[model samples]
Target: MTWDAVIVGSGFGGAMVAHRLISAGARVLMIERGDWVTRGEAAWRPEASFELTPSYARDIPYRCDRGGHGTTIGAVACVGGPSVYYGCVSFRFRELDFVGDADVVADSGAAWPYRYDEIEPFYGEAEGLLGISGDDAGDPTAPRRSRPFPFPPGELAPISMRVVETAVDMGLSPFHLPLAINHTASAARQKCVACRTCDTYACAIEAKNDVATMMIRPLVERGMTLWTNTVALRLEAEGTAVRRLVVHRRDSGEELAVEAERFVLAAGALGSPHLVLASKLDELSPARAAVGRYLMRHDNAMIFGVFPQRPDPTRRFHKQVALHDWYFGDPGAAEGAHLTKLGGVQQMMTPPKELVRAHLPLGTKTLLGGFTEQLTGLLCIAEDQPRKDNGVSVDWSIRDGYGLPQLVIDTSYTARDDLAVDVLARRARQILSNMGALLSYTHRVKTFSHAVGTLRMGTDPETSPLDGDCRFRGVENLWITDGSALPMSAGVNPSLTIAANALRAAAAMVAR
Candidate 1:
């Protein structure tokens, strides 16, 4: 049957659209490339998450030119996408983030066509809908919220509280990390166990409030049909609209042509562009040069501070403290003092023994395990400024198991991004030092976790692939509401922004 809307990818973007569109009494059909993830004890296995489990993460090979670093980008491919296994740092972008950075924008010629005020209400709607809970007091730089978070703040572990205490003493603004899990009976979420297996691992009891456990099932029950294990091969596009989709079923390898009046492309930054490029939409789009351009993934770093006190391994909730003292570049201060306007900082669960054993060397892993109870970590979610040059494109040279050109990610960060990482990582070290930590070290990577742009949203068709409402610039029936719609990724995680924009797009789609 031809539906009113066909939403692709059941992650935050697609899930939000499906929920809204179905609620509006529209016939909606959802397609997911990956099947549902592990549900029970298997979800708790850290060593085998990527190594053994059929989590269906796309192991796309990537290359970083300047640093000469290269590795496979393991983007999750499950129905709920990476939201099923995220750290739950749901934060709204600072207002200026949407307004665009004058310095960076001038240099790269990249800026959002819209501003924060337009999307502000949508942020609150997303928070309430997702049941986000946290203390907003610590981060004075946070955007003014229309309503308080859906639930009360989560309690912090002793080690994390200790770090917060020291950060406060050092004149830093620290508070409970904003989490999107059920914390009260009022919110109606599955009981949260607050386990250490939350950051990268799936929720064992389906209590983590991911899209699949929280939104997809309810939407399905309310008349939305979710086709899982379905890979979208290409779009059969006409003059100005998507006529139908040619999709491949992973289970039986059978091909099907599904028709819909309208389509919502929420297949993420990399995957969404692959579909468009493969459809040869570039040849038809007025913004062909910008189709897969201006990609931004925050240059992330983890700071592990070694304290003298031993942390209780039995307790699960460790990633509670957060610091947002430097939301933008530090202004003129004393000459010798360090300046940072790069990103926000937050606490993360201490690495479990199983994960530590799998990645670290024998001697180092053994020694680290001995002091495992003494290490606390801070994650730097830096704003890796967007550049038109870094993006995802079809690599016709190589084909995947699906016989299609594998998606290729070309991330060559600007010198400005390097500075952001340097300053943010340096500030993280200082925070731990002031807290009287024995040793503090950092590890940096171009993480696939928080990538944005590619099919960016803007008013200008020449510079962007989508309009302000996330509809493809020249395509009448195609819309995208994922990280791909973001013109610039701010210091915070991109999931909340993605969801907010999606809710906004759903409103537009239903209005028509």
Candidate 2:
């Protein structure tokens, strides 16, 4: 069958592209590598039999092959991809992120062809479509919005409120986290129940606004076709244009070839690059020197501060507040940082006695309760500069269930990225100290799950796989609409930007 467009992966990026294309009267076939769960099965209820255990979580593609420096990297393989299990914190990268710093820009080897201004309108559109909830009334730092949020922000739980107060007392501005969650039941979807099973778990209430509930459902209703549990092996290219795709169904173990006029790869940062490399298209296209190079992940650290007050930490919610003061550091400064409150940030109270005895500090059982007094914390998300040494390469020896090579991410942060994390940690400590917190504990810095930049976008084809519009330089009908197209890892999360850019790319494709 011939399709006007074939989108590989049904994540936020692919969903946006498919939705926009179908709306433009183009027939879209969304090929997803994971099975699709019905609406009832997708609900996140505690009573449900498969209520997100570590094993069940593994089923969602949460484990990453750890390379050196304890950097664990992984990707989701489900229909909606990572958005199905993400914390739902939606943030747009600031203007400076696109242009990048002079030193970093010169060294990054690539830069975003388009700026924030060019994509701001799409951001607004995406926010509306995703039903983001937040208050724009008092946030002067927020980007100008075309419309108010669909629903008010979720109420601040005790822990989050305490953090907000402490941040305010420290002269740091804190705002309600702009989340892609429906806070109240709307015509399009239901509201959040404030369940604690966010982050690592899927939303039981269908309020998280993942692609399955928001974008894909609407597209399916509009007659767009979706092939679940079907993985694309490689692209068949005729010179500069892609002609057909070879796909394998995981369940049936049957291989099928499909033709399409255009193809959008939203297989995510790690997976997207892996697919390209596996296809061996590098020799034929060779547009970018950096295809799987410069794999960037947020260098993150969690600082948990304990105050004299007892704040409830078991509130079932995603995100309530974020600290953007350090998003842009002093001009000409080397260090930059940002902080956010973790919804599930708390000291584990009931660990196995043997495990607790083995790991806890000497006589630390008494300290556990004291540590829970003020559960205010900050997650330091610092930008990771692109380095040729850090990257994702295919392990030809290790094949997955689909008979394709598995992704072997060989990545680690540079000293510069570590410095950025250190800067943010120091700032967090100062702010916590100012809040009069009696005790504090800091978790060692680890790479965040938000992976990006495996297939970066650039102005020159020699340096990047995709151009400004995310089109593969040599492949006429192929484009990437996911985080892999990001040239640099912005300090903030990339979901909102991913959706916006996908919309922009889809519009450009429709025009073509």
Candidate 3:
């Protein structure tokens, strides 16, 4: 059957397009590479090991071609994508992110073709659909809103209260961070139980608004095909249009062809670029150089804070407060430094010891036993300056167990990104310091979750693979509606932006 649209992955972008397109009276087929994420009481158990379970995450080879360096890429491989395991921090890009300011733009021709105002409506829609709970006016760097969030902000936790108090005492504006989880009973899903297993683990009770629970599930009865455990092999294009999609049914081990009027590639930053290059679609791209370039992972870290007293684990939620004071840069910072307001600061939950032990300092790990109860984490996200040479390449010599080529992620940040990280760490230290914290340390880490800019959108086709509307530059029927479509690396998480852009991409296609 030739459906109206065939979405390649059931992530934020894929789910948004499938729901909208099907609701508009068009047949839609959503292909997901992973199996359906099983939700049960195990997901709610605070000490459960559901997140790193083989069913939830898949490991692929990530090699750096420049230095022949390699590492395992652990990416979420479920129908709902990474949204299922994320911390549920729902944030919109700052206005300067879209205004083409020099701070946000990268030298490899990274500048969004449209402004924030044009995408504000979609941001509102995404927040409503995801059931974002927050005080609209609380966020200082928040964009001008058309309407309030569907759900009001929830109360702050004990740790957050102290954090906010300390920040306020220091004359820093601290506000409730926007979160996608359902806080109270509403038109959305169930209210969150405020469990400790939220960030890394999947929500068993359907409270953490993943696209599968919020968008695609509602459209299942309205006529949308959700094929889980199905991997897309390649897109067979006839001249300028996609003819059909070749796919592998993982459950049955059968290869098949699915036809559609148009196609949307939302297979994530690494997956999208790999699919294109592996399919040899770059041969047809007008700007082949732009197809799989400009890789970005926002410089992110977790600052562990130790206090005089133990933090309450039963508090409603740990990630309640956010401070944008250093988002632009603090005045206390040294003068003449190129550091602008850096990134975002929010409360973070304690990670599993097994996962964090390796990243922690040797001296810090030995001292962790006595301070475990008093230790809490604060997440810091910084804008990563996009680099042209840092990107994903198809590793020809290496193949995965599925016989597909391995993905080589050759990515690293610039000196500017380091400055942002330094600023963010310094600010976090100041806050934890002012509160009479015993010990505070910043541990930097990057993974596939925050990956973006692999197939950026821009005004010039020569520098970007997708246009402002997110359509492929040379292929008329193809659109990229994932995090890869984002041109600039904003300081906050990219989930909200991915959903909003997908809404925009769907509208442009439906209008045609």
Candidate 4:
């Protein structure tokens, strides 16, 4: 059977496109290379399943091979993709992030074809659809909104209050974090139970607004065709248009070829580029030389500061309040530095034993006593410079279960990206010190889950794989609507931006 559109992945980007296209009377077939877990079975509690076990690692896909790059990066092989297990901290890029003089952009390609003003409306629409909760009045730098948040901000947990106080004393403006969570206990979804098992764990309460709960389920009910555990091997094109996609069942190894009038690749930054390269499309479309070149990941680090008193540090830990004083640096300046809500900082809580060992260098007993007081902390998510050296290439020699080549990601941080992360870490420590919390420990700079810039977008097809409208260069009827299309690795998380861009791309496709 043929479809109007064939979406490769069912993450935020793919889900948005599917929802929009189907609503516009288009038949969409979304293929996801993972299982579909219903809300009831989404997560396994400690009582139900052992912690740290492979089964407990719900919503995220397991990686098979680890190369010289000592990172164990995992993507979700589920219907909703990583959005099912993300922190739900939805945010948009700043105005300057769209057009920046970062060396990576100059070297890789041109700036994003569209500006903040062009996508602001779609951002608002994305937030509404995702049920984001926050008070826009508190965040000065937050993009202008036509409507208020769907729900009130989440309450601040005990540990988060300390971070908030410290940030305020340091003259930093902290506001409630805008999360894509269903705050109300509606008939369809339950309220957030303040489970501390966030970040790597799935939300058992269905409160987290993952793509499955928010978009996919609704769209599926509206008659969208969803094929889970299905992997697309390559695209078949005729002249300048994509004709069909070859796919296989990830588990059964059953092969099937699908034809679509339009195809969208939302397989994520690493996976999308690898699929394109593996298809040998580079030979068919050589002008798009930068298909897998300027790769970037938001270089992030967590700063943990312990206090003299025992802090509750319970699962009800605050997940709101962001400090954006440094998000962009000075007023009237093109780029100012800023941070997120302090309540969200508590999400960085170290495990009990690990927290004690890191803090109590003298003894575990000493650290146990200090645990009674609140420990203050924050995460430093700095923008990473796109580098040609750090990229995702196809290793045809190594194949997955379906015999398609696996993605070989040769990603590393540049000195400039490292410097940016270090500067953010130092600033976080200073803010915590000023807030009167005893500095305990600072984690090494690590990559935040946000990855982007592999198949960057630009006006010049010679430099970028996709044009300003996200259509692949020299390939009509094919587009990418995910983080891979991002030109720059903005300091903020990329979820909201991805969703907004997908909507913008869908509108463009509809007009065409």
* Highest-lDDT candidate: 3
Best by TM-score: 3
Deviation (Å) of 482 in candidate 1: 0.8
User: lDDT of each structure?
Assistant: 0.78, 0.71, 0.80, 0.72
Model 1 residue pairs with clashes: 328-341, 329-341
What TM-score quantifies how close candidate 2 is to the native fold? 0.86
In the range 1-512, model 4's lDDT, one tens digit per residue, is 88999999999889989988998999999998777654454363433222343322333322323322234455556778888767788877777677764453546555789888999889988988898887857565677666677777888886677667877776767787778877688677688877665554567777888888889989999989998878788898888788999998757767889999999999988778877887777665545567787777777777766655544436464556676665544232222223221111223543344333433436554654345345645777767677666777776676765666766666667665665566666667776677566765665543325778888888776777888888888788889999999988777778999999999999899889
Evaluate model 2: give its lDDT: 0.71
Question: TM-score of model 3 relative to the true fold?
Answer: 0.94
Model 1 lDDT, residue 312, Cα: 47
TM-score of each model, paired residue for residue: 0.93, 0.86, 0.94, 0.87
TM-score-wise, the better of 1 and 2 is 1
- What is candidate 3's CA lDDT for residue 271? 86
Q: Write the per-residue lDDT of candidate 2 for residues 190-294, one digit (tens) a residue.
A: 777776555545676677888787888789989899998888888888887889889987689899989999988898886688778888766655664687888
Error of 1 at 277 (Å): 0.9
Alpha-carbon deviation at 242 in model 1, angstroms: 1.3
Residues 1-512 of candidate 3 have per-residue lDDT tens digits of 68888899888989888867987899888898887677889775544444456554454555555422136655677878878878898899988878644764646678888888999999998988888988847567878889987887777777778888998898888998889888777674578877767887888888888877887678777888889888888899888888999998978989999999889999999889888888778877777898778888788878887777766565446878888877776567773156664789888876555545544567767667446667777788988877788888887788876666887777776777777887777778888888778878777766657888899998887888898888988888899899999887788899999999999888888888
List the candidate numbers ranked by lDDT, top first.
Answer: 3, 1, 4, 2
RMSD of each: 2.5, 4.8, 2.3, 4.7
Task: Give one digit per residue, the lDDT tens place, for model 1 in 408-502.
Answer: 67777677676766666677888877766799756575556677899988877888888878888778999988899998888888899899999
Runs in model 2 with CA error above 4 Å? 37-74, 136-141, 186-188, 307-310, 313-318, 330-376, 433-437, 444-448
